[model samples]
Target: MTTPRKVTSLDVAKRAGVSRSAVSRVFTPGASVSDRTATKVREAANALGYRPNVLARAMLTGKSKIIGLVVAYLDNHFYPTVLELLSEALEREGYHVLVFMAAHTAHDIEDVVGQILDYQVDGLVLASVALSSDLANRCRASGVPVVLFNRKLEAEGELAVVSDNRSGGRMAADHLVSLGRTRIGHIAGWDGASTQRDREAGFVEGLHAAGLGMFAREVGDFRLPRAKAAARRMFDTSDRPDAVFVANDYMAFGVMDVLRAELGLRVPEDVAVVGFDDVPSAAWPAYDLTTIRQDAEAMVTITVSSLLAEIGGSNVTPPDPLPVRLVRRGTA
Candidate 1:
């Protein structure tokens, strides 16, 4: 085999008739170099097959240009939308995303955080962090800036961007109530997540606003089989609810399946239903689900942009909660 060709900063500096510092500054992000000097360095680099060493530059500047993204929402289609947007946005900002996935288990979150630390990422975006208070502290101690999106952690002082979950829930409740739905019920997501808690709170608050209370409710845990079980129990009641609001579209699909096939209930007539997250499947010909829509693309864009700002050594300003809306469809 032929020996690998080695290109170094010294070679570029010699060719450009400049110091090594000039070549280094030319490759460094946001570093200042004279236009003539930069042009010479570029020409010399191209001629010599010289490429900047990203790893060495990171060591020198203490910036990896890598942002770690932790997610716990693979089961929902909404998460994939977020991931796709984040990848594109981060790429544009010259920061690479190092994604780590955990499927709703809070138990292993610390370990995953540890893995992120090992990668020496400059910042972190928590898409669906199942973070305990202690785990949050651990991440803070690691000196990596964290920005939470879609899911908020219990620990205060963590930068977060989320939709107006409560408002979205209330809107759903009010819409169903306006349609003359009286016996209303709820399917809550997993108990631990702050997002799920806020949604449930908002739905309950909206019912109170409508001069009513929930006829029944169950914990769906934001999963399919568990949600189906919750739906089954609620529908099997002697006083079955006329309308139900499930926490997410993925779980809602399970609820609808059980209600139609097993319980033999006609949707929007026997029992109206609404859900959240507005996954593409929600508007499909078969489901046509009316649901709360949190703009996944916008959320991802904000998260990635924020992380890149931190990675670029800029002072990142926290953003306010994004708005969510209800997308109407045939199911309700």
Candidate 2:
């Protein structure tokens, strides 16, 4: 059996008795074409079973209408929600997303970004991933717009959209202090992340303002198993903390589980727990974890708008970090 020849736009144009350019304009989004020409092109395309080749048009227009998304990991519920929102927003804008997985390290991200750039993506969004200065320069030279979501770079003028993590941390600390919990402890996330750094800094500043120091501290590295182990170590002692601030909701769930299950500690009575990122699970009755809300929808909106603006030849400034508010629940 022989393979059939693929129908091209020329075939449709010949059948419609219209210029090839008219058929192209009809398929091109936002392109102006007369109603009569469009009707003829549609009828001919249906008869010939000819579909406009997006990649072929991209070669002519120099716009792939594709956005490359690089993510470190999606173990945290917050990231998955953001990913879904970003995908939806881009789809509505007539763009497609090409997702790439990479480790959080600079080297790994650099390698992954190199691969993404090769696809001629119109823009790049780094979610929970950082881009190095060298890689940033290369992307700039290539004229590809880059946006950091839930992440940031030390370099100036990089576009990023994220929740106000520092303020959220301070709010958590204030809430715990107002409850008259003096022996406040903290479960830290990965030391390398900007979110972890800013959140911890604000929490420490709040503690200092109250004339208190951390009763105990342990590094969870943003993993559930590590958080559980850290909880065990923090609570096993007779001189345990009366309250704890967990870095993120994902780790908080583990800390809460270990507190109630392994250590048999009563929450908010024996020890108050506060967490960041009010993920859906945090509101569940089982945990009812009081946390800092990140406003994922707001962040997604800003990220998508900023990225598209940059892609449209607009010089975009990084927007102010989205505001976060304290969510009260049974945990705290």
Q: What is the lDDT of residue 267 in candidate 2?
A: 99
Model 1 lDDT-worst window of ten: 304-313
Q: How much does each candidate deviate from the true structure in C-alpha RMSD?
A: 3.3, 1.9
Q: Tell me the tens digit of each residue's lDDT in model 1 across 182-207.
A: 99999998888888888888998999
Tens digit per residue, CA lDDT, model 2, 180-258? 9999999999888889999999999999999999889999998899999999999999999999999999999999999
Which one wins on lDDT? 2
The TM-score values for the models, in the order shown, are 0.84, 0.93
Q: Which regions of candidate 2 fall more than 4 Å away from where they truly are? A: 1-5, 47-49
